[model samples]
Target: MNEIVTTRLKPVSANLSRHKGVRRHAAIFIAPALAVYLLIVIAPSIGTLWISFTKWKGIGDEAKFVGIDNYKQLWNNDTFRGSFGRTLTLLIAGGFVVFLFAFIFTMLIREMRSKKLIRAIVFFPNVVPPVALAIAWGVLLAPRNGLLNEFLELVGLTSQTRTWLGPDLLFRSIIAGLVWIYTGFFVTILMAGVDRIPAYYYEAAELEGASARQKFTRVTLPLTWDVLSVAAVLWVILAIKTFEFIYAFGGSGTDPSASSWTLPVHVYVVALGNRSPILALGQGSAIAVVMVALVGALIFLTRRVMRRAVVEF
Candidate 1:
């Protein structure tokens, strides 16, 4: 009877052990990451949203529910409007300059002799810290004593050496700096997109008597359309979050001037950034939430606009 019972149990045990047990173990493997994400990302985002509706001083005080009072203030504030407008200008104007130069650079460097070296040189700015880039440019554009103005003076263009950091030109300078820093990165991305086109496409275009511009329009642009779409989406996201470049202006606890302030700077100034008596914690949190929403909507719109049937090789 005991031997018969053992033989029966062996078959049941073998059946249970037939599989490698990945399904049962997968939950255990993923649980840690899920826990971290919930704690860090989800919890903080929820907390921020909650804070957006409250009047807490970012201290150990109980939050007072103030409804949309913060948002009302922001809506009326001229400073906020200018900041938002600057962000838009950066997104549109800066984007155009970055893309235009990036495309030109991609086309030019693709056919150059030392293309790899040039590529690395172009990509160096993307790796540099945003603050450092801003500081370096700021020094070069300093009104009274800058390398650019000095050079202009040396070249007998003394009258042209105006204040680059003044109110009239400060925003333009920032936009231009953004273009310079980002152009290389987009160029690299576009080069990768264009490189994937097999040489035979160009050969066919040539056989059909296609001009240089015609080849670009017909073969290169069509094939790399997907990459261009992706690059535009990425650009919009990065441009929206532009903080460090403008924030570097206000070093240490000092806030950037109204003229130089971007949305992120505005958000920072409202929260804990105030040197005044009252800290508008709710207002800053609301601004951040609005920005998050804006970025999401733009990303969704970008995907919708750029969506197309895949052109597989």
Candidate 2:
């Protein structure tokens, strides 16, 4: 009887094992997307990082291994260094202006009677294409006959009516142009964050007789911090990779006279300009590598420093 029972159980165990195998096969089918991501996204990013360690002219057959030479050039090259400096300046100044405007606009809209209309108007700039926004800004800030200069001249402030895109005002003008183009997007982001906060928090603070400033400082700031940090990261990345607004508004190509060139422009000037193909490719790739490193470091550090504390709300 025992031998017969063991023989009957063997077939049942085999079928159960086959079912487990089928489940494992299904799991494998489900994993193809992740595998593709590892190959496509993760692999390429790692490859670019490796290329940065090499002196690969963009069209080269073989990359010359030059560990840290590209980084060294970034530190020593005046033009590259200057562009990096301008990038940092924009990151801080432009980033702050966008954040401030976004925050104020979002708050004001929330308090408005016609909130939807106000929100739509505020977000209008974001709907406009970046290139068109750039062109419009160029017209507005044009040195001689710009709307700004015209207004300044009317006020008898002739000194302030000077060239907006000239070397002296190039950086600030670019910052302002970028702020105009980007503040709307930031405002929309902040508004979404603001919408998530519980109204009860404000009500409780109001009942406590908290001044407006105190309420903002104690209640609003901390609660909104997580979203604001996300916005900051986005702004930081945009500032580092600022190409469109500067390229379009500052001038079509690298303006030798304009002080607004950032790293992307620097890379274009070095790699794609009418200069010798070899030098252009070499220096361009080098600059590209450095820009990647700088931006990567910033993002990493930012994530480390500003990683949001999880809130129960």
Candidate 3:
């Protein structure tokens, strides 16, 4: 009896020792990455949080502890309010339009013989520098002698030609440009998800007399819910941080109008724009903190809303 007990104990002890050795090796491999993350991401975030509570210009100025006054000022600033509202518009309305067009394009090109070429054309804008795209858009929408206005005149619809970059229309134009830029990227993602779905599922549905719309609703959408959720989260982050496109869209050598500013642009305007003599680094930090918080909250809400049972194939 004693010899049998010792034989079983030996294997158990060896297995436990091997498991510990594997964990030790894993920890060794993870240490460098963990250290870098703490140094780069965690450290800066904490510093920014600290700076948000103080009033400070850029280097050479002493930081004054203000106890949330920066946030209070931000709350009262009309320009900040407008920028925040525009940011939300870009996040919500822009996301809706982008996904809408992405779905449409994906459905259209999914079965096309020339789908690769079409996809490459659509995704070309994403590879181009956003600043360059914005400049091109600005030229196209210029109040006079612009290509769009010229085309309108040629088509005998001169009345439809107005200053596309005017204050009344600049934000709308930016939103439209954003939709055009991002739709292709989302289409690529959704197309990948759609492609993974077995063709037999659609065949099965068709045999049951399912129409095109019905197949899409009952088959495609359900299988791709996880991908769509991730894409939505990615859009939220991208939309909030958008800056260069809007900044350059206003034309060179001058700041964009306050009406077109998003939160990221607002941070630049507050902390470093030529319009201000002294930088409001503290206020900018406050804005950054708010943006981080907003991103976190929205991501949490999105995950909650999109949570569903895994539909395994």
Candidate 4:
């Protein structure tokens, strides 16, 4: 009887030891990722929040507590206000155009021969560095010697060869470029969603004598909605990260005109592009804090609005 009890205790002890070993290895694996996330993301964000409430030059100067002065300044400034408005236009107006073109192209290309090649061509812009594309955009619209201007001149539509880079049209030009760059990514996402849809749905719709538009509305739209929701969230995130295109937009070494400035560009302009450089670290940090808050709120709102009952086949 004593031998039997000893053997049972041995297995129990081994099981407990195994459980402890598993937990130890799990911590060992998770430790590095947690450390990096805290150091790189969370720590910097917290530091920025603190810096926003103070007047620090981000260098050797000591931070001076200013309470809410930076926030007030940011609000009172007309340029900052305009920059935020432009940011919204980019997020909403540009988003609408991107999704519209993406859906149209997805439908057109889905039935075409050589679709793989067409898809590759459409997706090429996303793969290229946005800086290169932006520079190319500037050259293509370069006031007088631009490709479009030259074409208009060649075609005797010389009156239409207006200054594309001037203040009047610069902001719209930026929006158009953004729409073009982002549309491809959404197209790919939407097409993948379309692919997952069963062909039987379409066949049944056809047997019912459903019109083309009817099939799209009754079948395609409902089935692919889950993907659309995900795509919408991604678009908001991508639109917020619209710095590189706008930064490289005004050509090399030139500051973007006030009309074309978005929130991210405004942040950089305040922090580094000032004639008295490094003077407004606190102000810039405040702008950054606002951007963070807005992004979080919009993402939450978008997720809520886009939520739908899952339509699994």
Score each candidate by Cα lDDT: 0.86, 0.77, 0.89, 0.87
Q: How close is every model to the real structure, measured as TM-score?
A: 0.88, 0.80, 0.91, 0.90
Model 3: pairs clashing at backbone N, Cα or C within 3 Å: none
Residue 69 displacement in candidate 2 (angstroms)? 2.7
Q: Give the residue spans of candidate 2 off by over 4 A.
A: 1-44, 54-63, 253-258, 274-279
Name the top lDDT candidate. Answer: 3
Indicate whether candidate 1 or candidate 4 has the larger lDDT. Answer: 4
* Candidate number that wins on TM-score, 3 or 4: 3
Window of ten residues with lowest summed lDDT in model 4: 270-279
Question: Can you write out model 4's per-residue Cα lDDT over 82-179, one digit (the tens) per residue?
Answer: 98998999999999999999989988888899877888888888988988989888888898789989999999999889888899888888898888
lDDT of 3 by residue, 1-313 (tens): 9999987778765676678577788789899999999999999999989999999986888999999999999999998899899999999999999999999999899889999898888888889998889988877888898989999999999999988988999999999998889998999889989999998998999999999999989999999999999998999899999788888886454677787899988888788886553488899999999999999999999999999996999
TM-score ranking from best candidate downward: 3, 4, 1, 2
lDDT of 2 by residue, 1-313 (tens): 9999987878865676678577787678779988899999888667766776776656546778888777787778887778888988888888888888987888778777887787777678777766788888888888778999999889999887778777888788888888877888888888888888899998999999999888778877788788877888888788888787677666643344436679887776665653333344555666776777778888888878888674647
**Model 1 spans > 4 angstroms off:** 1-20, 250-253, 274-278
Error of 1 at 149 (Å): 1.1
Which candidate do you rate higher for TM-score, 2 or 3?
Answer: 3
